[model samples]
Target: MEGFLIRAVVVGIGLWLASQIVPGVEFRSTESLIAAALLLGIVNAFVRPVLIILTLPIALVTLGFFLLVINGLMIELVAWFLKGFVVAGFWPAFFAAIVVGLTSWVMSGWIGGPPKGRIDVVTMRQTGPGRWE
Candidate 1:
């Protein structure tokens, strides 16, 4: 679908920015960047949830801050799965994951395919009466 491809491209750009901002996060070329994006998505979909569940106690204890470690581990896992992408060590992967998350957040704000300035909310009251209240 077009939406999926657009999200992939956004994620790829996030990965590219991560490589630029974080040392030891390296990609060989655009091809590798695309590959990394795919792998990252797959890894996030399949592995991240499991890891999050397993680390729930730590995450809860840290007020969800430990999600950053899980994110870094997912980045490292993607690098391990892909040949042309390399993450030198844990610290680099941690910082790279932070950059990737931040980039994706900013890009999503700009590129989200929603009607401009529209807000969707659910209310208990019906449309006509008491709607404003």
Candidate 2:
């Protein structure tokens, strides 16, 4: 769908930004960068949920801070399967995750714009004195 492609592109931009901002995150080639972005989307869609469920207790005890670790793990997972997408260590992945998440959030708002064909409004008419229809 169109939404999915837009999200993927946003993620790609985020990954690119991460590589630039995070010292230890690197992509050897553009193709690898693109692939890593798409793969990260896929991993987040599928693997992340399961991991969240499995780590619920730890995540709760940590007051959701462990979600950051989960995000870093996802980045590391992508790096493991992806050639030329190098994450130097857990710290690098953690920082990269933060960068990518922030980039995606900002870009999504700019690129996505307002929602299409939808509006939030309320209207009311007086029927009988203070009684509304």
Candidate 3:
């Protein structure tokens, strides 16, 4: 999907920034960097949602701040599966996750207004004298 690839590239940019700024996170090669980007996107897409649902109560209790932990966990999980992609500890992952998440969000917003690549629109029709649809 075009959306998927676009997301991956955005995340790859974040990953590159994380590698430079986050001390404990590193990519031994460009291949590893790219692969980690793709894997991170996959983990966030599939695994993060289930984790969020399971931790919904805590997330609500924390006023949504706990989602940062979920984001960190997703980064760590990606690191677990990918060689050369290292998250030294929970803190490092947590901060790097913040960087990655913010980077992706800002980049996506700049690329278009949203990640979907299209703006939303609505149409209104008059069905009757005083009714609308």
Return the top candidate by lDDT: 2
Candidate 1, 8-62: lDDT as tens digits: 7888998899898888999988898999888888788889999999999999999
Measured against the true structure, the TM-scores of the candidates, in listed sequence, are: 0.82, 0.82, 0.85
Best by TM-score: 3
lDDT of 2 at 75: 96
RMSD of each: 4.9, 3.1, 3.3
Residue 118 in model 1: shift from native, Å?
12
Q: What would the per-residue lDDT of candidate 3 be over residues 21-99, giving only the tens digit for each residue?
A: 9999988899988999888888888999999999999999999999999998988998899988888999989988889
User: Which structure is stronger by TM-score: 2 or 3?
Assistant: 3
lDDT of 2 by residue, 1-133 (tens): 6776777788888889988988999999999998998899899999999999999999999999999999999999999999889999999999988988888878867777436786868998889978996
Local distance difference test values of all predictions, in order: 0.87, 0.90, 0.89
Cα RMSD, model 1: 4.9
